[model samples]
Structures are given as structure tokens and as C-alpha cells.
Target: MIDSHIHADTRPYEDFEMMAISGIEKAITCAHDPLPMKSAVVTLEHISRLQKLDVKRAQENGIDLYVAAGIHPRAIPTDYEKVINKLPSILNNPKVVAIGEIGLEKGSKEELKIFKEQIKLADKLKVPVIIHTPRKNKEKVIDTILSLLSENLDESLAVIDHIDDKVVDKVVDRECMLGLTIQPGKLTIDKAITILEEYGVDKFMLNSDMSSAPSDPLSVPKTVHKMRLKDFNDSEIAKVSYKNAEKFFKL
Candidate 1:
């Protein structure tokens, strides 16, 4: 199974081995933009370097690795200008599947401007996008993103991640893909399955956004197991756990 969204770049290298052992066969590791906070110092060049190491490490460990490039909402104030200028070349790398982990968080003017720019960049480059929604005022953020994309772009090319029941209906109505992240203090396995059960798994996928924070690397596999226990058939599990992501990201 491909963990459709993960920050494997920030975890210990052994995390890959753990993923393989836990039944995660592949992952799409995202490069976060630099933030003012002490922990966020990733630049485009930094993403490239990490992508190289990550791909090599995944191969050595017998796991497949795909990459996504973008500046996160928190990092916009720090590296937005230079990063945007260089993101085009950075994304040219064959392994980079989308331009994201980018979206609105603080809903600041600059954040919205950069988020729109990255979405445009994804469109210009003919690639998909993975977005991060604001923890606060999430419905407003989702509205802002959909409104921005409704005009010229295909909603299917964008993955509105970090979603919950609050905005799931809006996203589904917009015809965009939904990403459910299973992490501590966020969405859980039970809730994820419940969302799928209510919404049905068409343009949905599950992810273990396990990174530097407190999270479980085995979360994705566990969700898969839990879904089966809930009597989600193999095809349904394959859709949310693997096939949908494969179709969306072309991975």
C-alpha cells in the first residue's frame, strides 16, 4: 500500500524499514516550506537533497518512494519569494508527483496569495496538488481554496488534505479529491472509516501524516486492518488505501 501523504523526510531512516515491515509498500513524502518557528528550515534546494536521499533509501529498503514539492502555509512568510522562483525547476524532477503540502492556514493575505500562486504553478506544470487546510476556520479555508480553483482548473487535480467531516461535503460537491489524515489530535481510524462509510470512497484516500511530531508510523496499516474488521470489502479498502491515490497522483 502507498501511504499517500507522509513526511518521511523528517523521520529517522529506520522509519522506512518500519513502514516496510508494517505493510506500507510505498509513500509520497512531502517537502515542507520553511516556517518562522525553529523547526521549519526547508528550502527548495533542501527538498531536492532530501528527495534524493529519501528515494535512494526507499529503494535500498525495498520500498517505492514518490515526492511532492511545495512551500507549506507556515513557511510562506520566510521563503515564499525565492522558493516560488525555483519551484518550477525543482518540480521538473521525474519523481516529484505534485506541487504541494501548500494551502491556507493563518488566512493571512500573504498566505492566500502564495497558495493561489502554487496552485497556478501546479496547473501550468500539468501536475496535481496536495493542500493543507487551516486547523482554525477550516470551512472558510476550504471555501477559499475551492473558489480559487473553480474557475480555470480541474478540481480532480487537487487533493484537499487534512480534511474532516466539516468540509467533506463541500469538497465532494466541488468534485475534488478528499484526503483523510490519521494522526494524533486529528482524524482517527474509526472516524476515517466512518467518513468513508457515510461519504463512500470515490475520490478519497487515507494517510499517516507521521512526521517530527507525535504520530504513529504504523497508522496507515492499522487503519487498513481496522477497515477490514469493519467489513469494508477488499475493493473498498483498495480504493481508499491504494487505488484512488494511484489514479489521482498517477503513481
Candidate 2:
């Protein structure tokens, strides 16, 4: 299975082994802003860590690691243009899959500006994107993101992530895919199954969003087990746990 979204850079090295043991064969580690950004260099350094260190670490532990490199909305720095200029080359790394973990936080003009720039960059490069929706005012923030996606992005290449029931209906009809992150403060397994049943499995994928916060590295596999216990079919389970991510990320 592919853990569709994670931050292996912030996790201990052992978590990779545990995830592999839990049946995760591949994972996508996205760029995260752990602290306030000082410069574009810091963002580049973070992406480099995912590209080199995290990939090596995950591989050593028996999981194939892919990267999504971009400036996360909360991590956009003053010289963000510098990072933007370097992104095409950074994304050229074979391990990099999407331009991601980018979207609205406070919905500030600056945040929107950075978000738009990255969206355009992804579009220009013909790569996929992983968009983030904030914890507070998610309704408002998702609406704004949907507006930008409709105007600037190919629905097939966009992933609106960290969805809950509150906002799932808003995104279901769109052609873009959805991400259900099974992390603390996100959807529980029961809730995720509810969404899957309601929305069907065609466009939904499982993710852990694993990072410094309390998270289960085995979330995707655990959710797969839960699905098996229920009435879900093998085809349905495969779509959410593996095939959807494989087709979406082209990994």
C-alpha cells in the first residue's frame, strides 16, 4: 500500500520499518514547515532532506519513498521567489512526485499569493498537487481553494487533502481526488469508512499525514484491515489503499 501523504523527515527512523511491517510497501513524504520560515534556503533544505535523507532512510527500512516538493502554505518565506525559481529542477528528481502540501492556512492575501504561484508552477510542469485545508474555518478555506482549483488547475491533477465529513460533500462532485488522513484530530477509521461508503471508493485514497504530532504510521494498512472486516470488496479496498494513489502519483 502507498501511504499517500506523510512527513518522514520529522519521524523517527524506526517508523519506516514499522510501516513496512504493517504492509505499507511505498509512501509519499511531503515537505512540511516545522517552524516559522526565515528564508527560501530553509525550504530548499527541507525538500532536500526529503529527497536525499528521508528517501534513503525509508528505502533502508524496506519501504520505497517518494517525495512531493513544494513550499507549504504556512512555510512560505520572504524570498519565496527564490524557491519557486528552483522548483522545476528540484522536482526533476525521479523520487519527486507532486508539488504539494500547499494551500491556505489563515487565508491571508500572502498565503493565497503563494498558493497561486505554486498552483501555477504545478500546472506549468504538468505534475500533480497535494493541497492542504486548514483546521480552523475549513469550510471557508476549502471554498477558496476550490475556486482557485477550478480556475487554474486540471481537476485530474489536484488532490484536496485532509478532508472530513463537514467538507466532503463540497468536494465530492469535483473531478479531483480526495485524501482522508487518519491522524489525531483528523478522521477516525470508522469515520473514514463512512465517507468511503457514502462517496464510493473511486476518488478517495488513504493517508496517515504522519509527522511530529501523534499519528499512526500504520494508518493505511490498519484502515485496510478494518475494511476487510466490514462488507467492503477487494476491488473497493484496493482503490483506496493502493491503486488510487498509484494511478494518481504515477508511482
Candidate 3:
């Protein structure tokens, strides 16, 4: 199975170890360079350094862990140009699979500007994008993406992530693959199956979205188990847990 999205913040390496033990064969580790926050943002430079370390560790352990680099919408600000300029080298990394976890947030105009710039970079590289949509402005983000798709006609393999029941319909309706983050409080496997039944599993995929707070890297299996309880056929469960992600990541 493939985990579509994951961060390095919460118990980073431990999360992948748990996933390997849970039968996940591969995982894509996403990182964003720190932002110049009132405090400090985890910059892309830092993420690059850490990604190399994670890559080495994964190789040593015989686990397939890939890396993706991008500037998240929340990490954008006035000096975002400097961060944007450094993206080429990041995308060129041999282990980097896609340019992602990039998209709009419910922030100021400056943030939107930066987000658009990153989207352009992903387009230029012809790599897939893992979009992070804000809960409130999902419709707007979808519209923006649709516009880009219309113009490019060759829209990258995009994953519109963090989708919940509220926006699942619209997301699936657009024919964009939806990435459901399985967190204890955020979303339950049972509810995700219900959404799949309502929306169909053709464009659906699952991820742990595990963090340090409290999460399970085994969420993919847990979700599969819930699908079984719902009487969803094995083929359908496979599509959500593995097939969809495999096709998207081109694994």
C-alpha cells in the first residue's frame, strides 16, 4: 500500500517504521521549508537536509520512502520569492516524486500570490501536485484548479487532500482524486467508507496524515477493515487503499 501524504513534524522516522510494520510497502514523505514566522518556519533548506537523512535511513532499512518538496500555502509571506527561487533544485532531487502539498489557504492576499507561484512551478516541472485545500475555501480552490486545468489541458496528477464529508461530493464530482487523511479525531474509517459509498471509490485514496499528537500509521489497514465491515467488496477496498494511489504516483 502507498501512503499519499505525510509530514515530518510528528515522530518523523517512527511513523514510517510503524507503517512498514503495518504492511505499507512505500510512503511519500512531504516537507515544506520553514517560513519566516513570528517565531520561525521550517524552511525548505532544512527540509532538504532532513530529506537526505530520511532517504538514507529508508535505504538502510530497505523501506521505500520517497520525498516531495514544496512551499505550503500557510508558509507564504512577503519574502516568499526567495523560497520560490530555490524550488528547481528541490524538484530535481532523484528521490522526489512530485511537487506538492501545495495549494490555497484562508490567508491574506500575499499568501494566495505565493501559492499561485508554486502552482506554476509544479506545472513547469510537469510533476504531480499534492494540493492542500483550506477547509473553508475548498470551492474557490477547486475553481482555481479547474481554471488551471482548462488552460494547461495537461494538469498534473493532482491530489486534493484533507477532504471531509462536507466537500467530498464536490471534490469527486470534479474528477480529481481525493486524499482522505485518516486521523483519530479528524476522520474515522467508518465515515470514510460511507463517503466512498456515496461518492464512489474510483477517485478515492487514503493516507494516515499521522502527527505527533496521537495517530496510527496503520490507518490504511484500519480503513480497509472498516470497508469490509461495511460489506464493500474486496476489489472496491483495494481500489481505495492501493490501486488509486499506485496509479496516481505511477508506482
Candidate with the greatest TM-score versus the true structure: 2
Clashes of 2: 0
Model 3 lDDT, residue 36, Cα: 52
- What pairs collide in candidate 1? 34-75
Task: Report, for every candidate in turn, its global Cα lDDT versus the true structure.
Answer: 0.81, 0.92, 0.70
Q: lDDT tens string, model 3, 61-128?
A: 55577777776776654465666787787767667877677777765566556666776777677777
Q: Where is model 2 poorest over a 10-residue stretch in terms of lDDT? A: 29-38
**Which residue pairs show collisions in model 2?**
none
Report the Cα lDDT for residue 23, model 1: 82
Largest lDDT belongs to which candidate? 2
Q: Against the true structure, what is every candidate's RMSD?
A: 2.2, 0.7, 2.9
> Model 1, stretches more than 4 Å misplaced?
33-42, 77-79
Q: List the residue pairs that clash in candidate 3.
A: 33-42, 33-43, 33-44, 34-41, 34-42, 34-43, 35-41
Q: Report the Cα lDDT for candidate 2.
A: 0.92
Model 2 lDDT, residue 221, Cα: 92
Candidate 3 vs. true structure, TM-score: 0.85
For candidate 3, what is the lDDT?
0.70
